[model samples]
Target: MPPSRNYMTERLPSPQLLLRINTLRDRALAADSLNALAFSMANDAYSLLQYHQALVLALQGEQAELLCVSGLAKPAEDSPYLVWLKRAGRWLNQQLDGNQPVWLARADLDPPADINDGWAEWWPAGLWCVPLHNRAGQRLGLVLFLLDAPPPAPLPELLSSLWQTWSYCWQALDSKRRLPRWNASRSKLLIGLGVLLLLLLIPVRQTVLAPAEIVSREAQIISSPIDGVIKQMHVRPNQQVETGSLLFTLDETTLRNRAEVLSKGVAVADAELLAASQRAFDNPQSKGELTLLNGRAQQSRAELAAVKAQLARTQVHAPKAGIAVYSDPNDWLGKPVSTGERILQVADPAQPAMRIQLAVADAIALEPGAKVTLFLTAYPLTPLHGEVLETSYQAHPSDEGVSSYRLLASIEGEPENARLGLHGTAKLYGERVLLGYYLLRRPLAAVRAWTGW
Candidate 1:
């Protein structure tokens, strides 16, 4: 009889046994753990083979094949069963397109005849092979088995069920391996793009935006005109004043008294001169007396004028229209002011200007009317636009151990509240040239000067 007829002749499982098998199948299907599902399938296959007097094996793929044998004995590395597994892997790769299942019997097992001589003594009589495919329908591994003796009948339904369960386990394992690699590749790509964008933005900022502006030190001091006591101050600190506005008064009481005494002497000299002139005209012999009196009167008048002028200068006035700034007074209030001592500053608020100190080398290349942009520490948000108004022909020594030219620029649209001596920096645009010239100009100039190239 054929194997199919023999399998049918065997009695069908009892209802109770059928119910238990169904329960185990349901539990395996609902299992959340992939390992649990794999082990459950392996155990079920083992039980069925034992009851039916056969052998079974399960296989998983790594770099090499892993075989879980359920038979009369465990196979050694050189055993016939392991040799069959290696051959099965090669055959499955060729015939299955690495997908689907392949079943084998005595006629199907095609090991070399010489190798099979030992297999007849130690190996099982029957063989079954199933290819394990993932969800993508790619072969992940193979499952194989050998029976202790030829199965009483071919169990096609059992083999089909085993193939289905093995496929699910392989798919779960493949999913776990592939997801992390995909996520890592995606993350690296995004990070690289972000860094590239930041690098691209750097040059735009350097070329289009203005830099900070600075003021030179020499343009900011206020000095006194003469030596005298500061008797009264007419203006407060930071007050705005026009040219000739009185700022303070010095002690002038003594000068005023001297002026009054000179005035009385001038009056007496004038009366004497008038009397002498009248007498000279009335009597010719009085001519010498008239000349002496006239000389005396003229000298008295000159003295009076000198004393009056001295008194007038005792009050101090502004030299220019601007915002007044008092420097460190050094607590000198009500004290005498010496000649040329700086008392306060009067900065031109309406026509505010900035000074740039350029190195002698840089200054030589700069010409008047070159563009400049100024940035003050106090007003960082707005830039003061201007052009080089003037450049000193002579260079002055600087703290940087080099000589520099003082370049002046008139600040455009002077701010309403900008004070004198506010700290700032200036960037000179120098001369216009081509983009290529801009890049090579500095280096070439330096090399030519250094090596005569």
Candidate 2:
């Protein structure tokens, strides 16, 4: 058999204990309406537990103040209970480490000394101190009930359970007050990521855009056949001419004079030869003289023939059908040209190409057949398309005093209204690549060059 049980040690709640617990739970659940909830909890606790008063002191960071008061019609700031609460707050914070409710019985304060303004003398016979904490273990505040007698065991346990749930609601209210509604840094980070993704997905042509000009695809240069002074001009600068058209005539005054002189010399030699032949027929010793006279005549005739040929070539003719590409015609009218010296160019206007001078700094690796589009200064609204045919192996200084490489591009077809020497800009398209790579290629190249990395 079991020993006789000690019923006095295990106290039970009264019949109305469940009703009081339910009422407190309802108040705690409505903690979002904090002021009303605090008042309701305080009044209900006072009436249900038969306490002298109920008080809720809210604590936020380092601040502590009375939230609500019950069981007093005219509660004053100088009230002993409030004064005692203010004085004991620091001690209460240190003792409520685990956030468990502190059940203070009448026997516990027997030897208590005076507190703030001697408010310790007004201490209740028994009290319940429930320290409220959120689920994360952050202290919300403290709830105090001034007890007329020790509360039933179930009442303190029930209040502790209700406050635990109420702690969450209080936390929500605190967060709403302390935390920002929108975070600028978070928003900025999202925007930056979106821009990066957009840039990666978008595509653009990887092209090297440079200035260009329209030029003859293939030109024929006319040069002087012999050293002579220009005596006559048959064509104007930039004028179109057909094959065999006389282009220019060199001075022929001295040439004609030399030819006439040589002719007279030949005539004199022939007369001498005839006389020598007659003598040779009369005397055998005169045969050598005939041979000498004949040789002299032959030499004079050869010299005369050469002079006539020179006179004929004095009038230069067009080699092919094309425009006379030269500066002012007056520049050549009285000019003396050396043998093989270039006089002008005959370029077919129908066949046009692009000549580009790419700066060394702006140059990129290029392959044959690169597509190029030209926008002429004279026709900005029009564009001419072509393909790269050749590129210089080395760079040369341009008129602008910058080192550049020259490239030749053939037009896809004969462009309407296009002419030789038409100047414009060109865009040379290269292999496809990412937009970021295309944009940063130059800057990265510069950095590498500067750092030698």
Candidate 3:
């Protein structure tokens, strides 16, 4: 509660105290570090003052961390005595100034009950505190010595001179301890970061990968002309065929059965009309009925003709000479198809083009006539190059189940080397952008999607 006791105005110490002060001065000067000097002041240096147990602590952040204790190599921080000592150290750190030393008893501290309860159990009398200050007058740490009895004459004068001797060496070690650890790597780190930034700024062409296949530039889609189950496939995928060739046929059993029923009804109508004509000559009532029978007979013939025409359409034929492109014939053998459902493609194998399905998420602004590179799974070594001819404005679900934009690219030079229906990976190039943008585009897009930014 009171200011630190002032001992500077006291008379000079006697000869015996002078020799003791000089002995302590030699030990402080020879000390190598703050920890070593603190240890000596708590242990061997106790001859300068009468004290029992002692503690050496460093001020680290808001806590007084134990460094050493008298008669022990390491301080037992978990022990009840040290735990109570730490609580008392916190109160002392807040109240004491580094200007002078102070003697603290139980009433002087009036610490919290937790710290107060264990003080009498650990020490017999009062505690003496000496704060260590750097050259800048900042409190570095403190030393606590437990004393049961009063120190002999001239103890204050001797302790004041001893503090001056220890502070000089403590300041030198404290300065070195506070320096930056990575002094050697700072220049190398700065150079690496600068180089990385420049590399990111370099301009590069933006590209995207999409599944592609070699197809005809002008191909004909062969769709089902009637609603029926496919009975057979006459042409296979990539098979050569000519005009008027049977491409495929639907199930004719249902149409054939309908035609047979219509034919029998037509014959019965003609027989009834003949019988009514004969009766018309005998009775006037029969002549009126003869006209009705003739109309009925004509209607039956029309129905038969319609059924026959449907039967003719069951067998489909190729309209042009080209190769047929479709999947496994077994997949369509018993599958029911609707009218206008596409079954296969009739393409000219020599005039190959690229059909690329670019996913909507990976889509970039691509102009017509943009460069395209195709690496076929079969012919990976010989990459075929092409130019974009068309790109769909809207996205459609592809076979891969992802929404994609369909792209058609025209093959450069002769396309005879490549065949239709060959699958590959296409590399489509767009306008130039910063290398950083090209590399980080997907990651940045994912982050935006996650953050909704």
> Which candidate leads in lDDT?
3
lDDT of each: 0.62, 0.79, 0.85
Candidate 3, residue 391: how far the Cα is off, in Å:
1.3
lDDT (10s digit) by residue, model 1, range 1-453: 698887875656456555655655675667566545544554556545553222223334333354434433334878655776565455445544445444455556576665455456554565545566666676665555455443344445544564666577556654664556454587799998888666544432112122223343233465665667777777776788888998777788777788889889989999988887788877988888877888888998898888777677777788777766764334456888788887777665556677667776544366777777777788868767877778888888765666777777776665753556666667677544445455555688889999997
> How many steric clashes between backbone atoms does each model show?
10, 0, 0
Q: What ranking of all candidate models by lDDT puts the best one first?
A: 3, 2, 1
Model 2 C-alpha lDDT versus the unseen true structure: 0.79
Query: Model 2 segments beyond 4 Å from truth?
Result: 1-204, 394-403, 434-437, 440-453
Q: For residue 275, what is the lDDT in candidate 2? A: 89
Clashes of 3: 0
Which one is best on TM-score? 3
Error of 3 at 337 (Å): 2.9
| Candidate number with the higher lDDT (1 or 2) | 2
TM-score versus the correct structure, for each prediction = 0.42, 0.52, 0.58
Question: Which regions of candidate 3 are displaced past 4 Å?
Answer: 1-199, 415-417
